[model samples]
Target: MAKIIPFKAVRPTRDKVTLVASRSYQSYTQAELEARMDYNPFSFLHIVNPGYKYHKDIKGKDRYTLVKNRYLEFKEDGIFIQDEKPSYYIYKIVNRDGLTFSGIIAAAGTEDYQTDVIKKHEDTIEYRENIFKDYLKTVGFNAEPVLLTYPDNKIVANIISEIQKERSEYEFTTTYRDTHYLWKLDDKDSIRTISLEFEKMKTIYIADGHHRSASSVLLAEQLKSENKKHTGNEPYNYFMSFLIPESELKIHEFNRLVKDLNGLSKETFLIKLDAIFRIENRGNQLYEPSKKHHFSMYLDGDFYSLFLRKNNDAFKTALDALDTQILYKKVLEPILGISDLRNDTRIAYSHGKNDMATIKSKVDSGEFAVGFGLVAITVKELKAIADEGLTMPPKSTYIEPKLRSGVTIYEF
Candidate 1:
C-alpha cells in the first residue's frame, strides 16, 4: 500500500507567498532570472540564485552551502515560517487555458518507491540522482513536490470538494496567469482520512520528476546507513509529493524536428516510408495526428499524413507499442539514420501547445529539414508502461500543473 504523510512544512509568509513562490529555477531564461533577481526583492530566485548577490557563479558543494545560507536568510528576514503542526496541503492550480488541477501535497515514503507502491515510467540518470541527493543532503529541504497520480477515488474527490468550499489560506495569481490556492489539512480527522484513503491504494505513478523521486530515495538510503540510531520514521525516508488523480493530469505531446532527411531525397524518403505507412499528401495545410499509429509530417513546404499500415510492426511489450518508439524504429532509424534521440544534434522538439506553424517555421527557416506531430499519450498508456517496468522515450509527455517552489517546503 502507498504511504503518504503530513509534514510540518516551511513556507513563505502568507502575505509574501505570491512574491516569494517561483517556478523551477531552470524554467526561467537567463534574462528572466536576472530581471526577477534585480527587480523583485521577494522573488524566490534571490534565494536559489545566491551568487547573484556576489556577482559570481557558485557550483558543486560550495553552491549547495550558499543555497542553505540564502534559505536561512529568507527565514531570518521573516519572509518564511514553519507550520506549527504537521499538515497536508490541498493545492489547486488553474492555468490560463482554464484547465484546473487539485492535489494533496504530502510526504511520500521513499520505501513506497522501493517497493513499487510509487511507480515511475521514466529512467533516471545515476549521475543526476547522485548530484541531487548530495545537494539535498547539504540544503536540507525540497521546495518543489514530485507529481504523483493515482486512480481516481470518489471519496477523495468528495473530500477535496468539501474542503475547497472553505476560504483558502493562500490564494494568489502568478505573472504566468495561473491562479494557485492552498488550504491546510492540519486537523486530525482530515489528515487521517486522507492518509487512510491513500493507504487503500495499491500503487501511485510518478507523473513527473523521476529524478527527484529517485534522488530522494538515494538520500534516504544514505542517511539511514550513516545514522547509528536509524529510525524508519525519519524525514529523509519521505519525499515531498503532490498527489493528484489520473483524471486531472494534463498531458501534451512533444513534436519532433530533424535537421536533414538522412541522405535520402524527398521522393526516395516517401517511398521508403510507404513500406510501413499509408502516406497522404496534406499539402501546405497544417495537419495533426488524431489517433495512435497516425502521424503528421511536414517537409519541403507541405504537410502529410502517415498512417501506420495495419499489423505492420510487432509489439512484444508496452514500450514496443509506444508511438515514439515506433517513429524512432521505422522512420528515424530506417529512413533518417538518426538513432540517439537524446544526444542527436540533428533533432529538436516542441511541445504540442506550440502549433504546427511553429514546427513549419523552424523547417522554413532552413534550421530543420522536416517536422512530425503526434497525439499525446494518454494517462492509461503511461500507467500501463510503468506497470510493465517500461520507460518511455525522452520528452514523451509534457505534464502540467507545473508547480511553484517555496510554496510548501519539506525540510529534513
Candidate 2:
C-alpha cells in the first residue's frame, strides 16, 4: 500500500504569497529573471538565484550553500513562517485556459517508491539524480512537490469539496493569469480519513518529477547510512508530493522535428515509409493525428497523414503500443538511422500546446527536414506502462498543472 503523511510546511506570509511564489527558475528567460530579481525583492527567484545579488554565477556546493542562506534570510526577515501543526494542504490551480486541477500536498514515503507502491513511468538519469540529492542534502528543504496521481476515491473527493466551501488560506493569481488556492486541513478527523483512503490504494503513479523523486530516495539512503540511530519515520525518509486524481491529469504529446533524413532523399524516404504505413499527401495543410497509431508528418513544405498498416504485429508489450515507441521502431530508427533520441543532435521536441505551428515554422525555415505529430497518450496507457515496470521515451508527454516554487516548503 502507498504511504503518505502530512507535514508542517514552511510557507510565505499570506500577505506576501503573491510576490514570493514563483515558477521554476529554468522557466524564466535571462531578461525576465533579471527583471523579477531587480524589481521584486520578495520574489522566490531571489532565494534560488542568490548569486544574482553578487552579480556572479555560482555553481556546485557553493550555490547550494548560498541557496540555504537565502532561504534562512527569508525566514529571519519574517517573509516565511512554519505552520503550527502538521496538515495536508489542499491546493487548486485554474490555469489561463480555465482548466482546473485540485490535489493534496503531502509527504510521500521513499520506501513506497523503493517497493513500487509509488509507480513511475519515466526513467531518471543517475548523474542528475546524484546532483539533486547533494543539493537537497545541503539546502535541507524541497520547494517544489513531485506530481503524483492516484485512483479517484469518493471519500477523499468529498472531503476536498467540503473544505473548499470555506475560504482558502492562500488565494492569489500569478502573472501568467493562473489562479491558485491553498487550504490547510489540520483537523485530526479529516486527516485520518484522507490517510485511510490512501492506505487502501495499492499504487500511485508519477505524473512528473521523476528526477526529484529518485533524488529524494537517494538522499534518504545516504542519510540512513550516516545515522547510527536512524528511524524509519525520519523526515529524510519522506519527500513532498502533490497527489491528485487520475482524471485531473492533463497530458499533451511532444511533436518531433528532425534536422536530416539520414542521407535519404525525400522520395526515397516516402518509399521506405510505405512498407509500414499507408501514406496520404495532406499538401500544405497542418494535420494532427486524431487517433492512436495514426501520425501526421510534415516534409518538404507539405503535410501528410500516415496510417499504420493493418495486421501489423508490433503490439507485444505495453510500451510497444505507445505512438512514440512505434515511431522510433518503424521510422526513426530503421528508416532515418537515428538511434539515440536523448543525445541525438538531429532531433528536437516541441510541446503539443504549440500544436503544429512551431513544427511547421521550424521545418519551413529550413532548420529541420521533417516533423511528426502524435495524439496525446491516455491515462489508461500511462498506468499500464508503469504497472508493467516500463518507461516511456524522453519527451513523450508534457503534463500539467506546472506547479510554483516556494509556495509550500518541506524541511527536514
Candidate 3:
C-alpha cells in the first residue's frame, strides 16, 4: 500500500506568510528579480536566487550552501517555525482570475512513487534530475511541493471540509489578487486519522514536478547509501507534496513558436500544409481550436483555423491522439522537418497563460515567424495516458498553481 505521512513542517509564522512565500525564481525576469530583491526584504527569492544579492558575483559558487544558511537564518529569526506535532495543512489559493483550489500538504513516500501508486506522465531529463538532486542535497530541505492528485475520495474530502471549518491558521490575500488560506492540522488524533484516510487511496498522479519528484527518489537512495542505520521511515524517504482531488486540477496548453519557415515562403508553406489540412483564415483575430482535430495558427499577423480532416490510425495511441501529438505528426514532422521537440533548435514553446496577443506580437515583430495556439489537454487525457503506462508528448501540458516556496518546508 502507498504510505503518506503527516510531518511537523517548518513553515512561515502567521504574519510572515505573504512575505516569505514567493513564486519560483525562474518566473521573474532579471529586472523583476532585481526589483524584488531591492524592495522585498523578506521575499524567499533571496534565499533561492542569492546570486543577485552578492553583486551577481556568487556565480559558479555553491548556491546550495547559501540557500541552506538562509533557511537556517529564517528559522533562527523566528520568520519560520516548526509545528509542535505532525499535521496536514489545508492550503487554498484563489488566483487573480478567480480560479480557486484547496488541498492538503503531506509527506508522500518514495515507495509510493517507485511503485507507480504515484503515476507520472512526463519524461524527466537526466540532467535536470541530477541538478535538482544536487540542489536538494545542498539546501537540505524541500521548500516547494511536488503537486499530486488522487481520484475523488469521499473520506479524504470529508476530513478536509470538516477541518477547514475549525478556523485557519492563516488567511491572507496577495497583491496579485490571489488569496491563500492555510489551516494547521496539529492534533495527534487528527493527524493519525488523515494518514489512515490517505493510505486507503489506490493511486496518486504526479500532476507536475517530474524532475523534483524523481530527484527526491534519487536523493533518498543516496542518503541510504551513506548511512548505516537508514530506515524507510526517515524523512528523506518522503518528499513534500500537495495532494488535491483530480477534479480540482486544471491543465492548459503549451503553445508552439516556429523561428523560421524552414526556407519556405508563406505561400509555399500554405501550399505544403494544404496537402493535409483544410485551412480557414480567421484574419487578425485570435483563433482557438474548436475541436480535437483542429489547430489555431498565427502567420504574418493573422489567425487561421486548420482542421485535420483525415484522421490517421496512429491517432489511437496515447501520444498520437493529442493535439500536440497531431501537430508533431502532420505539421512538425512532415512539413517543417522539425523532428525532435526536445533537442531541436528551430522551435520553442510558451505556456497557455501567455495570451494570444503576446504570441501574435512575437510573430508580427519578426522575433518568431509563426505561432500555434492549442486548446488545452484535459486532466482526462493525462490520467488516461498515465493509466496505460504511457508518456505524453513533450511540452504537452501546462499544469499550474506552481505552489509558492518557503510557505512549508519538509526537511530530511
- The 0-to-1 C-alpha lDDT of every candidate, in the order given, reads 0.93, 0.95, 0.85
Query: Weakest 10 consecutive residues, lDDT, candidate 2?
Result: 307-316
TM-score of each: 0.99, 0.99, 0.95
Which pairs, if any, clash in model 1? none
lDDT of 2 by residue, 1-412 (tens): 8888999999999999999999999999999999999999999999899999899999999999999999999999999999999999999999999999999999999999999999999989999999999999999999999999999999999999999999999999998999999999999999999999999999999999999999999999999999999989999999999999999999999999999999999999999999999999989888999999999999998999999998664588999999999999899998898899999999999989998878999999999999999999988999999999999999999999999999999998
Sorted by TM-score (best first), the order is 2, 1, 3
Pairs that collide, model 3: none
**How far off is residue 132 in model 2, in Å?**
0.3
lDDT of 1 by residue, 333-368 (tens): 878988888888998999999988999999999999
Model 3: weakest 10-residue lDDT segment is: 52-61
**Cα RMSD to native, each candidate?**
0.9, 0.8, 1.8
Best by lDDT: 2
